[model samples]
Target chain A: MSANKSILVCRCAERGLVDTDGIAGGESVLVIPDLCRAVADGDPMLGGAFSEVHACHPRAVQSLFRFAGHPLPDTTQVIDCRCDGAGHAALGTMEDKPPAWYPVIDYDRCSSCGQCLEFCLFGVYEKAPDGRIRVVNPDQCKNNCPACARICPEAAIIFPKSVEVPINGAEIDDEAAVRANIRVNVDEILGDDVYAALRARKQKRKALLNRKKIERALEERRKCSGGDQ
Target chain B: MKMEKTGVHGIPSTLQERDSLRLRVETYADQQGLVPPLSMEELRDHALELAPSSVSVDYVMVLLNNAVWRETVASIPYERRLLLLPQCLRDFKNCPAEMDEFGLLCEECGRCNIGELQSLAEDLGYVVLVAEGSTVVTRLLDGGKVDAVIGVSCLNALEKSFPHMADGAIPGLAIPLNAGGCIDTTTDVEHVRNAIRLRSDASWVNQVDTARIREMVEGWFSAIEIDSMDTRTEQIAYEWVCGEGKRWRPYLLACTYDALSGADGIFPEKVRRLALAVECFHKASLIHDDIEDDDEVRYNAPTLHCQYGIPVALNAGDFLVGEGYRLIASVPSRTADLMRIAVENHRMLCVGQGEELRGLVDTPPFTAAQLIEIFRRKTAPAFGAALRLGALAAGGDDRLDAALRRFSESLGIAYQIHDDLEEYRSGEEHDLRASILLALANDQRPLEWYAPDSPNLDHVFREMMVEEKAAQLLEHYKNEAIRALNPLASAPLKSLLRRTTSKMLTPAGGRA
Candidate 1:
């Protein structure tokens, strides 16, 4: 059976209904496994009662999080339905956090293979209609995964594995914390300047540092040779 | 009369020994105040500076001494085995003197001791003499008197012998305790036994196998009748593609498939061809990748682009890719259909490449959905295609194909996610792509819309370490892969498939 059909059947079975193909208590009914079990036990009334429950919530289905038994953490606002009799989780609300995603890229080594765009199942990539294979739209991503990075032969893709917001009393930019430090620095330093003078300055600084390093290495070599004599 | 040492290339085992002898000859070149006979500029320069002051009597003696020790230590059977004069042996070498007698005394008591050793040496056509230091040993070995050696030494002999003996193949056993640390008294009966064992145990043959995939290709070339008129062209074409490679990807394919099929079980030739075809595809990509990446070396050898020049290398890569298509197409009809899926994977690969390039140019917040979609298309398809090919090659049922496809895709995604995490974890300096993760996690909108984080916030950093976000995603995908594998009838294939999938979701323990 198709995955959707399986879900439908599972729902029918869980309601303990006699899945008869007809209107039952003002609801459409169909044959289901639990209904058969109830009928076999000669509990026609129980089966009928099952059909009634199905009628009341015909579209009721468990969320992916609920199905996986990893419902989102509770906060002050949203009610937590999976709590016990104890006062601990007895009253809880679903936490409000921004939708999270990780992107995997290796800027130093990326040789720009457009495999991620072609492979993506969602409309997650907007390859330039001009034939550039770049992802113009990542808002349509699924499951917050960064799969583009792994298949990159030169490892030019980056993705986040985890994102945690420090729950301490101090305020923190949880979003900035999730981004890479270098990227954060670059954004801060370069700040919307696509062609910043900072680029030349940084290159100059690197060149100066490299010269100093070379001079130091040469001096070291001279010392070793002199010491040998 | 003196015999001059002649170094020849043809008969000697290694170039090193001949060079050493040549160095000894040139060590005293400075005394002549003339340019050294050596033609090579570097060697000539070295000889001028390093040559000794003179090639006098003492120097010649030292040279002979060095030769003897080298012979004993190196154990190469040479012609000039003995440098000692007959007079040196004639005087006090073989005969033993009594304590009271001034003249030599030889009482043959048949005790089978050093006296016997000396007499037996003459009978056996070997040399028996009391020598002082390595000078004598070197002279003997260099003189070609012995192909192997047995040295019995006191502390002095042991120390003297150890410098060369430590690295030599021949065995030399030590017998301790002798007055004045002489070699004669320390020589023991057991030393003979050790020498016999050493000779029997050691093999002097060179053990090096130069066989490689390139060699196999060469052999095939030789077997095939390439028209002599086209021979040069064929050689060029063949060398262009094969180049110098260990063919590591092909090796991995062969090994992994063998492992998947339960070790050493042969698959049909068609399947084998498919496996090889995949490897060829991987290599062809690498060849092209090297050019695009501007890399100089691959596997410690010059990259194809570097060696053959970029344009030719590019053509060679294209040619190999063309060959890959031919190879895959040669497989059975159904397998060919599955292999065609590889074309889709190739498309995904290209898309991924473009995404990466674009990401560097533009900085914006990406949603989780967008990133996952990229992963599915880019990373998952290639890996998924590989697994599907393997399944199809095995003639797996529909259930098996569906199961493997789902398992491979999920596993591929998890593997990609783990890889992304690793890139950043390696440190910011190591990977430039860490920006992607940062953008995804922080930028929830277009670049202009997002507000920068204030410096005072440490709590924000803590939120970035939430392992559950990735762990949950990983577990969900891994569960799907496992669930897919459960229905397979072949326990072994199921186990193999499951194992391959599990490897993707494994916890990070080791660093690359």
Candidate 2:
């Protein structure tokens, strides 16, 4: 996309929105700082400059545009610039993803003590309209804070293992190395029994994943064959 | 012929049936006010009285005996409690493990859960014996080395051991193995662990009624209650403060005080005021923060500023700040010390808040470390103030104050990171200035991910990379907070703080 067609506004003044100096059409990419305030102040010239405005919160930016009294261009696209600098560069290629981790309540074990609901400062767990306590906002849960689980008398709450994403070009080997280190640490601290159990659990998980992969492949093949028929 | 349902040794087969039997036995024991050392006949009589005529009298008797002794067994110190595991629990076929005079020495091969159970029980200071038969247990009790026994045995073995336990007057908890095979049997490890870890000392956790404390704090804000304390400004401040909140700040203060000074006695009046002071500071900060952030709502209600306008809200916030200082000054003991600590924390909080406001003027792509640093500045001091004031109210020294500062800093940073993750998941408007997720993605992901024409930035938020990194940091800080308690001499305080750390961070089914 031509730089003139896109405006990159950095709400953060500390770092320039992007290192625009290196790009071919980088100069045309307007790097406006404190864009929220600028838009809130009804900067008339701001809206006429670009067809598309890229900023951290697109919804907020759109509101600002409306407040500024500038009619949005027909081709206007308010790109959400909430992601980090690296994410901004690769936004289009990214796919919809599941939550990295969340709490899963074992109904059988839960006594409906409501301790979790009371304990969580964040509105993560809530009383449902039906009056049952539920994980109403799984996303609001602090991925690592299992405070509610610890306080739970019946030990009903469980969280999924956090997803590990490869950083930079770190291959699967790097991930394996990290896991190996963790295993060694666990063995040293919790003894070989825990280590063995963890290894067995991991192996089981791998087997399940492999089976799912095979099933998906078979399903795809069947679909193709059915289409031909 | 119809097969009769039975457990390992003719107990109830299903868990529900077993639990029902145990509950009945316990109710009978409770009604009788029975303690341990009841004669076999006495236990049998009580069990028979509670049990239905169709139910086995022997099974009910054993259940009643176990129930009566549980509390006494729990009251015994770990050093005096013996963990007796049946040798049959081992994977005897695969076992290369050796045995001494005491019993089997687990090789920790992990074929069965024996090794894990042994290691954990030993770590908790229990003299774990991986042997069977009642003779050894009775001999240990006769020697007076063991006051209580948490025994894992088959139903037959548990029955055999009961007469010996009753003879010795030893408080014991019996966990009947799931099956009766002599070579290898299974028992619930969690049940055993819970038995071993049980202590009457930790009953203080249940004693502190958080609901009651919250009610008392809420009472402090009532118009009639504050009528004598102050008139005009106090009433206005109470109007804003009386709004619904989790009241975590005051709760933390009260918990800390109760931890330091046992909850058995009356709560100190000065500590109560100090807790109220912490809330005042918290409420004041919220009012100012709302106006600064231009937030319209708080606690599902209109913010102080939005309700009464900025000028009135600002005055009310200022009044709260003054009231906080007044409350601290009113503390009967260590008035100067309390004042100094409060001022220091207040200034630190302001500096942190100022930096945050400054950052908004020119938003930066902050790194995770930078975001954490901001968190420490903004959040840590508030927690520190509450903790230190509680300590100070309880006649704590400088050493305790120093430790609390470190603990609060780690806790505060972790807490803020937790909030960030929460906000990210809620799909709320991103506050880019101090977002660890944004910082992490910027640092870790490739530059292409931030392209102007990138279709969806949603992937960045969903990427496990940032969340995982933040989780690791959260764990690190949580451990740091726990570690800070090492210098603490009071076991109860240390334990309470440790539990608090767990309550804050432990996810359901997460590691203990």
Candidate 3:
């Protein structure tokens, strides 16, 4: 929760992602015309990490660093300046966002089982000729959904913007990965689907946004479960 | 850097060229027999191979999904389909359109094609959504109100929505905008026109009045939930009856009766009594299951034991069991026959639960086969009773009862496995500390079973393909459930049973 003065701002003017003068340039503040192109072009300016990043969404910026082979540490804070500039006095979150939500795979954890590939409907994942699975279309991922993560079996899939842990790049535990019982877990999700018998069942589950509470409860339950045993 | 409206854009900008590209994609799709939900890489790879180098993958992906879903979309009746248009298609400055929760309310303004397409689609009974994003589209689909969708959107929007349609296996065709920017994007009107008018002989399937039948069942149960009760125990029993249930047991009974007798309108009084009996049996089991498992919550609320003490909850459960037998015997004409069905299922349920409960003994390690046998007695009999009672009420023969028994066993076992996996995954409280996943894992690798909360357990479960093996077992039983229906000569029962498999088990249940 402490602040860092050294900030990098990506105007991202090409897609109108941020305001041209959202920030009043200072000695520690560096303003790039577009961070997206900078990442794509392997700009040397991105060689080091920044404690504070004034960009679009925190997730988008983190994803850019993740894909660019220099993942931001959990300590870094990203402030969205698409609507209002990340002024030295005020660094508010991006209120109006474009479609930048996508999934990032932890290849170390992926087994190429193709479960995520079969589970996804949006064609976000693909199987290579070598049988390795890859996130093919990250942009097509639904915002705030970590369903693929839930069914990953390996807990490899992460939604950078997700409010849930493990899914949000935190550590996994019994609460996040384990369930009360396999049958009960399946029944909870599937039974919720049944109640909405008239609609798309999984789709309802896909956009279930109040995940922070459920996951927190899961964590507490896991610890208690361990203690009770 | 905005382009002129309806002029500058990439990827087959001309209507003629776009149409030709659509034709080529359709031909290529036919050759490959490509089924969606197609992965982005697959769609991109196929599009690159087929379309000219000038065409974009975004353009081709839309066309590719459209080509594959063309037949399916055509089969869905216009009433069950939605024609979605973007507001950017409107000449917004002059467009006289209002918006609603569903979509744009068009004023038939001549300035834009939004009016034209909306009018044509609405004429054919297609639900029209002239809006941005797909929240409403998702809601309509989730509600099971619409089965198919035809939409014109920018590639970016289509990319986001593709998965929802493909995942549900709901047929859809999307046309990407070829000209202009987001303010006033332009799509080929001909493409929109053709998609709107799509129709075939298979456009609809005639069926009984199921929506109304569900309505009647829901209405009756709701009334019973709040009906005046003299005793506190009766009040508690009825309150539990209507709480957080799909009323599947009763619904199955009604559907079975309908299929057997071909009754279209409201059900008779005798059938309703039998239906209530089926639910009483199910709810009673839940109360007991809660006490046994010590689960604090059910149906997203406090369990009966949690709400009341275990003693009162147990009494209410027993009361319901007695009520079930009483309901079945209320009609004296078929009391003996119906009572036989009720008593037998009740005994089977007790036997099944008895095996799992095991008379307060220490937890026993169970083989996969033994666990499944428990499901046969614990789960299947209730569903079998529901179907059998409906059939008996409709004057079905014993031959039908035999088929129903086989069908329910498969369905119940599958349901149990499904519940088994979900409950395990949920980490909800349960007296049975065993898991099918752990059992399957132990069989595969011969590892000592770890406690449920161990991180190593999950890793081992994943490493040994625990979910995959269990899913296979689940799928096998579902198929077996379907096969059991083949023996029935009754067309209505057979057809209803076939659809029931897909309806109940199909969600996130691969290949259901």
DockQ winner: 3
Ranking by lDDT: 3, 2, 1
User: How well does chain B match by TM-score in each candidate?
Assistant: 0.46, 0.61, 0.61
Ten-residue segment with the worst summed lDDT in candidate 1 chain B?
B80-89
Residues B1-512, candidate 1: write the lDDT tens digits.
11122321121223464346435643443343222111122223443454444422322222232332231323322121111111111112344332110111223334425445444433433333333233333323321123344444333333344333322212222332222211123223443333323322222221111134234333332443434435553344445444555543343333334434543444456655665566556666777778877899887888878977888787767766776677788876685566666786777777865676565456554456656666666667656655666666655556766776676677766777666555545542233332334444453333333333434222443466423455567667665656555555543344345444544454454311
Q: Give one digit per residue, the lDDT tens place, for model 3 in B261-307.
A: 76774688988898889999999999999999789989899999989
Q: What lDDT tens digits, residue by residue, belong to model 3 across residues A68-159?
A: 66888887787766543332322222334333446777665778878678656567899997998877777566543455666665666766
- The better candidate by TM-score, 2 or 3, is 3
Chain B, candidate 2: TM-score? 0.61
> What is the iRMS for every candidate structure?
40.3, 22.2, 11.7
Pairwise DockQ winner, candidates 2 and 3: 3
lDDT of 1 by residue, A1-229 (tens): 1122111121123222222223222223333333212322333333121212221111111111221222222221221111112212111111231122223233233344455554343445545655544444433443323333323333334322111111111122453443332111122332333123223433444466566669889999999999999
DockQ (C-alpha based) per candidate is 0.00, 0.01, 0.03
Alpha-carbon error at B222 in model 1, in Å? Answer: 16
Kindly report the TM-score of the first chain in candidate 1.
Answer: 0.25
User: TM-score of every model?
Assistant: 0.34, 0.45, 0.50
**Tens digit of per-residue lDDT, candidate 2, span B40-150:** 656676776777765667667767877876765666677656677877677756776654333465666688888788778767776666763443444454322345678
